[model samples]
Target: MLSTKTLFARTVQTTARRALGTTTTRGKHTVPDLDYDYNELEPVISAKIMQLHHDKHHATYVANLNVAEEKLHEAQAKGDVAAQVALQPAINFNGGGHVNHTIFWKNLIGEKNGGGQLHDGVLKSAIENKYGSLDKLQQVVNGKTAGIFGSGWGWLTVNPSGQLDVVTTANQDMPSNIGHIPLLGVDAWEHAYYLDYNNVKADYFKNIWRVINWKDVARRYDEAMSKF
Candidate 1:
């Protein structure tokens, strides 16, 4: 058998190689491609708005997330807790942006499909149980979205107890971090609807429902239920 010291040296070298490989593998983050084309949800969301939101706004978030992660790694390597804490906001903002947009893109569907209808299932039951009916849930969510003073998100979330809720967060804060699993999220930022709806955010919220991918929301509800 090899001497203990020699074996330890070899193990250290192997670990170093793995670490170096991981560092070298870090690469530019790419924007996720949409499953549907712009204009696919026309009449609810305009093609021009979709293109700009995905190509310009969401891309910026992905790029910034990469930069923030790199800075976080640098701070961690230096053992600088203060620097790490200072970078937390950058991490949260960009990370939340990246995450929320990723879900938002998939949560929409083409008008050709039965986009907004929620058929009978766990999702329907959950909504009925929590809000008395789907209409009530929508009313609460829309009202909350309208009440937001500035850019933020309105969400339907499932708590650990399997109860559904409507909650709004300022800016890009995610509901998951606060112990709720997001079932559906509506982006209320001016950029999300300004091109099509202008200053009428409530109108946008109400109209956008026509293209909501209830299939995705149902799947999320099912998955959340399974985890319990």
Candidate 2:
């Protein structure tokens, strides 16, 4: 039988390969199928919200990214510097949207599953070292994420110093856009939890921890630290 670490290592390998587009076809970006059903993350995240967030919102980002990339290709071919410059925002917004959601899905699990559990591992140790305990870090992240005045994402990222940090990015901006490797991310946009939590963003932030896939996070942390 595989050890827990080995199994998680395999999961990380598969997830990383897919996220990097190594296993996907070139050209267009695509919406990935969740490992479980949309209803799997229930109570913490409703099926209606997941359905709309993934199938609708995320899918739209993928479509828009493909469109932007296609137009970008045309602009580059024609040496249209002005057009290319104008298209940068679209590419970044939609591309970041696609990237962010991809990580976001991998960051969650069903409540009955691994979600909400921060098992003993490198990630736990790192979190403890950074913020004293898992609970403390979660509070910090939730507070900062809740404080965002507009749509954005809250991320637990591996910083350049090989340390963990909780950071918030406005809009669809990715952590990688600023040289951080996002291990876990929570979408703070209204569409993510408005149907269930309404305008109470704090409740959504607090409840989201119940579905966090800490195994995926630890695996990601392991990989990121390996580079240091």
Candidate 3:
């Protein structure tokens, strides 16, 4: 017969295994399947680029995240807080890469079905109130994204007060770290568009609008607004 304390310890260990993504030693983090085919966002984004970005770059992030977590767990078991702290950057980088790319894939679609338009709604009003107009918001977002010195992201996020704001993060740092709720995030890492747009990041930024999924953005905005 097990003591109450023993049962509690077993339950905690089980939950920890699930949270660390190591329930099965042989298991690896899997790349999420896109809702649409690679070519589905054609014209706005190339199929070749999409395939490489999703299957290669984003897959690498997921793999690295799993590795980082494993290392962090080892450090924790040894009671080495310094080693655990050192692992923070790797965990943030890979974890953020996974999160940002996941949202990026969903926020894009073919333009034929009115994918990019921000119809009049709560989201539109919020944007207009914050940045004057959608075009203005795009200008700010594009400028911020292009200005990133290296790999990073530009985002339109909602603050706790429910006000829309444009912000940027260096490397893979997420908006949540800066006290903002990200509504839409644009990956500024060269790998995101170098194959298609080459050194012309501005061109890529400008063209991204054609595939922007306003519906998804609106949904995120609505949810964030509710939290305020």
- Name the candidate that leads on TM-score: 2
Candidate 2: tens digits of C-alpha lDDT, residues 198-226: 87888888899999999899889999999
The per-residue C-alpha lDDT of model 2 at residue 67 equals 78
lDDT of 1 by residue, 54-173 (tens): 999999987886786677567656655566666667656776787788878988897688788889998898788878987888899999999998899999888867778888888988
Task: State TM-scores per candidate.
Answer: 0.86, 0.88, 0.86
lDDT of 3 at 25: 42
Q: Candidate 2 — which residues are off by over 4 angstroms?
A: 1-26
Clashes of 2: 0
| lDDT, candidate 3, 1-228, per-residue tens | 986645544444443343332352423566789988898878767899899999999999889878877876676677665666666666667777777788788888788866788999999997888888999999999998888888899999997677898889998777877778888888898888888888988988998988888999999998888897
Would you list the clashing residue pairs of candidate 2? none
Runs of candidate 1 with Cα error greater than 4 angstroms are 1-28
RMSD of each: 7.6, 10.3, 5.7
